[model samples]
Target: MNPDDFSRVRSLWTHCGLPSRPNGRDSEQHIRRELSDNTASFLVAVDPDETLIGTVFATHDGRKGWINRLAVDPRWRRRGVAQALVAVAEAELRRNGIEIIGCLIEDGNDASEQLFVTLGYSRHDDIHYFTKRDRPDI
Candidate 1:
């Protein structure tokens, strides 16, 4: 997805129950900046009607590939939309020479955790995620 896709992408995110922190990284400016990253891929899945039904953001920190912001319209869930998005994102990351790919699924999001597990991702309960954010919204 490019900067031109901001509106549609944001709309799809909202429809998929994803957060839209306009004041933070979800804004068009930040999105454009992310798109500029050489290792980043913002992918969107569209239907025959040209409507975006899913999205996934993939990037690597010169080592491990990270998948984030995966979302699929509620109406499209359980139909393989998320799975396809993830597959394509993984392929893009691999194309960039990333060897280890991973994702962070929030606690209590059983569906997402299960999906990742079913896709051959192992859960590491031993690792704890820590983040230092300048602002909570970001």
Candidate 2:
């Protein structure tokens, strides 16, 4: 995504129920940084009127490809926008030599789970995910 698309993308994120963190990751700086790192992995889909309808962000750390922030406008859900975004991102990752691609879907989010499953992503029940906030203790 380009700098010009930041505000629309941010608004879309909010509309799709994705939280915005205090860190720079949720800022324009972060979007610029990620796009600079890998432009092809950051994509946005728009309709004929040029309104942002969908978005997906993917990145690779030279070992594994990670997909995140897959959001589709509520008015456009179940219309193949999310699937198309994933398909393009996965293809880009594979073309860049990434062997493993993974996405994290929150528990109870059955729609996302089904989308991934329908796209052939196998659930790895053998592994658990842990996280640490980058910010310091209050």
Candidate 3:
């Protein structure tokens, strides 16, 4: 994503009901960090008029690829926008020699879970997710 896309991306996330607390981790600072990382991948889908519709962020920790922040405009859901974003991100990761890619879906987010499953991602029950936030109060 380009530097100018930050406001539109943040708006898209808010419109899609994604959690993005102002001045928090999902703020512009974090987005800028991701965009500046040469090894990271960020994809944005826009309409012909250039309005943001979908987005996905992918990163590789040298071995496995991680996908997150997949969001689509409510008006454009189930129309393959999310899938296309994932495809491009995955392709980029593969080009960088990444073999295994994984995504985290919040519990009860059925649409997201099904989207990944339909794309051939298998659920792994053997592992658990953990977080260590520098500022938990946010």
Which lDDT values do the candidates have, in the order given?
Answer: 0.89, 0.85, 0.87
Residues 1-138, model 1: lDDT tens digits: 868889999888877777667878788888899899888999999988988888999989989999889998887889998999999999999999998999998789999999999999999999999989999888
**After superposition, candidate 3 runs with Cα above 4 Å error:** none
Top candidate on TM-score is: 1
- The predicted structure with the larger TM-score, 2 or 3, is 3
lDDT ranking from best candidate downward: 1, 3, 2
Score candidate 2 by lDDT.
0.85
- Of candidate 1, the 10-residue stretch with the lowest lDDT total is 14-23
Candidate 2's error at 17, in angstroms?
Answer: 0.8
Candidate 1 lDDT (Cα, 0 to 1): 0.89
Over the full model, what C-alpha lDDT does candidate 3 score relative to the true structure? Answer: 0.87
Worst 10 residues of 2 by lDDT: 19-28
Alpha-carbon RMSD to native, per candidate: 1.2, 2.2, 1.5
Q: Which residues of candidate 2, in runs, are more than 4 Å off? A: 136-138
What is the clash count of model 3? Answer: 0
Task: After superposing candidate 1 on the true structure, give the runs of residues whose Cα lies further than 4 Å from its correct spot.
Answer: none
| Model 3 poorest ten-residue lDDT run | 19-28
Better of 1 and 3 by TM-score: 1
Indicate the TM-score of model 2. Answer: 0.91
